[model samples]
Target: MEIKEVAYDHPDAVELSDQVQAEYRTRFGYDDTTPLRPSYFDPPRGLYLVAYENGAPVASGGWRAQDAEDEGYAYGDAEVKRMYVTPGARGQGLARRILAVLETSAREAGRIRMGLETGEALPEALALYTSSGYTPTTGFGVYRDNADSLFLAKPL
Candidate 1:
């Protein structure tokens, strides 16, 4: 598989992101009323990475520098976001590959740590984060009071 930088507007990237959001809603019973906005990807502080195999996008992930209000739990850090691997690509370590790329990018950006929030229902994701050296962290970002959310962080 090959990893590449992707713009939010990339066709495959946009489609895969939509699929991911749908999966999140299906798996965790989240309302589809509030979509993850496109503007989240535009910035001086965000990085989006996509992984491809056989000329098709299979996985993607990104990180953004934490905002001032996020300092309580994510100071001097970047927040991992939008991690997803297509169903056909599951169990192939594609997610891990995407994560490695994102982590490297964050380190290159001078970030000392990385944090993320995943739903408790995603056992595979929880396992992946734990095996990748991330540890449980206090709530962060817009998910501070979300009961189904599990936060994790790793020092870069």
Candidate 2:
């Protein structure tokens, strides 16, 4: 698999992003949730990555600078966003690869820590984060008080 930095407009990246958004909505009952946007995707605050196998996108993820206070803390950090792998691409470590890339990107950007919020319904995601060294954290960002959201963080 080839992991590459991709623009938000990249066709395969966009498609996988849509799949991730759909999964979030279906699993958490949200109407229009998404992991990437102009504010995060534009300028020097964010990064998007895609994993391709045989030229087909198999996994993707993004990260962006975020203020800890927004989620009920006071620290400078980066947030892991939009991590997903195609259903057929599971069991091959695609998600872990995407996460390693995103974390490296965040650290290179001078971020000392990373955080994220995922729904409780996503057992696979929870397991991945836990195994990857992300520990349970309090609500962060715009997800403060969201009952279904589980926050996790790790130091870079």
Candidate 3:
């Protein structure tokens, strides 16, 4: 797979984002409503990545700087978002590749930690994160109050 950094709103990114949102609706009965902007994924502060196989977009993930004390984030934290692998691309380890790239980019940008919120409904995500050395972390973000929300973090 070929992984490339791209704007959050890039055409391919948007298509994959729509797919992820649709998957979210199928899994939790509603789409994720996190307030996100393209600027949030801009370089130096954040980044978004897309992975392609045979020139077809198949996986994506991103990280945004998050340091709001009131929001329970740390001073040098990077929050992961929009991680998804196309249904047909499952089991190919593309998600892991994208996640590794995201972590490396965030680390190079001086982020001290990486954090993310997933859901119980996404067992594959939980497994990938846990196996990647992410540990349970204090919940943050819009879904923090949701009983099904699961937060994880890793030092970068």
What lDDT does the true structure give each of the candidates? 0.80, 0.81, 0.95
TM-score of each: 0.88, 0.89, 0.98
99, model 2: CA deviation in Å? Answer: 0.8
Model 2 sits at a Cα RMSD from the real structure of 2.0
Model 2 lDDT per residue over 22-86, tens place: 88778877733434564685436778888988999989888888864745744658888888988
Minimal lDDT window, size 10, model 3: 139-148
lDDT per residue as tens, model 3, 42-154: 99999999999999999999999999968888899999999999999999999999899899999999999999999889999999999999999998888878898999999
Task: Evaluate model 2: give its TM-score.
Answer: 0.89
- Alpha-carbon deviation at 154 in model 1, angstroms: 0.4
Task: Look at candidate 1 and tell me the lDDT of residue 92.
Answer: 92
Q: Using lDDT as the measure, name the better of candidate 2 and candidate 3.
A: 3
Models, CA RMSD each: 2.3, 2.0, 0.7
The candidate with the higher lDDT, 1 or 3, is 3
Off by over 4 Å in 1: 31-44, 70-73
- Candidate with the greatest lDDT versus the true structure: 3
How far out, in Å, is residue 53 in model 1? 1.9
